[model samples]
Target: MTEGLPMAVPAQGLPPRVRIHEVGARDGLQNEKAVVPTEVKAEFIHRLAHAGLTTIEATSFVRPEWVPQLADAERLFPMLADLGGAPDIELPVLVPNGRGLDRAIALGARRIAVFGSATESFAKANLNRTVDESLAMFEPVVARARDDRMWVRGYLSMCFGDPWEGPVPIHQVVRVAKALRDMGCDELSLGDTIGVATPGHVQTLLAELNEEGVPTDVLAVHFHDTYGQALANTLAALQHGVTTVDASAGGLGGCPYAKSATGNLATEDLVWMLDGLGIETGVDLGRLVATSGWLAERLGRPSPSRTVRALSHKE
Candidate 1:
């Protein structure tokens, strides 16, 4: 265990304990061209829980035709009723609209997330509606979830850049983010959907959001490694007092609508960095590495996580 560990050197001006929101089971596998069996998805999530990931996203309640890989959301989610008896673990799922929300609620999903885009192009491409129209659609979904006293997370994609629209203005992102926050979202996960965000851009966005009355305490960051800036952007967000981060196991998924976007920030890699900084993530680095390696084997490809590759020694 020590051989693969990093020397703990606590950093200043960073959150003491960062909560990693694991998105592999939902975001990662949703883009798989080959359908991953429902049993494999359940076992994969179980493995993630055993590796000490407390907030593993279980699955999405989107239309089966839209995301065929996750078509078994009905069957796959029920299998995770017991997360190896891990107490206080969160299993959030994505809900696109009221229908999605209804299905999730019927299945007893307590923590749900709504995916939105800052730009009109992505909103239309992903949701087939204008930005305002999509927000209108999500309004009821968020309200219903909140009315049920369930935790709601708003995922604002294209916060940094959009492939179709080019660089998304910080103000544009702030507007959409404020709408989501005002709509009873308990937390908001800022997404660099096209993976073009830098550290400075991340800090500025956080600052702008703060200036717009969106407190730092209710914020999370989600980045991609397209330009190799996800870790840097994450560090910037951490420095800005963000404690929640969205990462995928094995760096699995990208935006299906954005061809230029890449895989998410790998959870194992993020844990390695957090461990080095002495930031408590409650994740066992050795176990996380092994989990990614295991998933990679099942996915029929090597993991994109640098830490997993370096530690597995068989890549």
Candidate 2:
């Protein structure tokens, strides 16, 4: 739906236009050691929108004690209300529970995301609740958000592997994913939180979801680059008909709850592949690369994205 962007006609299986859900502002900065200033975070979102990102996750409404980095969610959303000169973008904020949802709604957030885990250990560790309890908490949040005419996204983490529990079964992943979908989530993002998923794992999980009557159109893939297979796993998902892919600009985040998790798949890296394959994403690779570089300076390190490094060198 981005202006001037070509649509991928589902040629061999891949969607013509892949929707890149930019999670840099929320997911990317949440794991940083030094809290990025609120103004810098707002500017980062604006720049990403200017670079043609139609859906930019602005911030999370989680408790400040839980994620101190994104504590300014209320302040951040107001700054994004007027995107300066960028395209009209959907800014989604993460809400951990009914309380978080209340805060997001108070800020006039039209879109929000709720996170759940497939494995019990992670559910307990990250959320301090069992998987069922976590889903129970999200049920009301999702229902209330829908009542408010807001979009709700559900994130299922550790779909392939869990640090506390190794090698999660596909059926378990499907069970959790289905629960989220049944709860009326507009979309469900399957996350490889530990980044241990390979292409084969991706294909198998997607296939099982499809077999279970969960449409790929309602699913998104969020991968971490820890094992260096994020992009490869993403390509496999695309071949399986997934059109939404989540990435962080500059590869700026890791899972605090998942000890071994690394930064997410970089937006610039994904855009480079989509551009080369002639898959329309509406992102300007050059501008995305620059945006990553700009954020990297604030993070006090160079971007880990291979594409960002390669493009920066060329420039």
Best by TM-score: 1
C-alpha TM-score for every candidate: 0.98, 0.95
lDDT tens string, model 2, 79-130? 8878622446788889999999989888788889999999999999999999
Off by over 4 Å in 1: 84-86
* Candidate 1 local Cα displacement, residue 312, angstroms: 0.5
For model 2, which pairs clash?
8-16, 8-17
Q: Please name the candidate that would achieve the greatest lDDT relative to the true structure.
A: 1
Compared with the true structure, all predictions reach lDDT values of 0.92, 0.90
**TM-score of candidate 1 on Cα atoms, chains taken together:** 0.98
Error of 1 at 228 (Å): 0.4
lDDT minimum window of 10 residues, candidate 1: 80-89
Local error of candidate 2 at residue 176 (angstroms) = 0.8
Stretches off by above 4 angstroms in model 2 are 1-11, 84-87
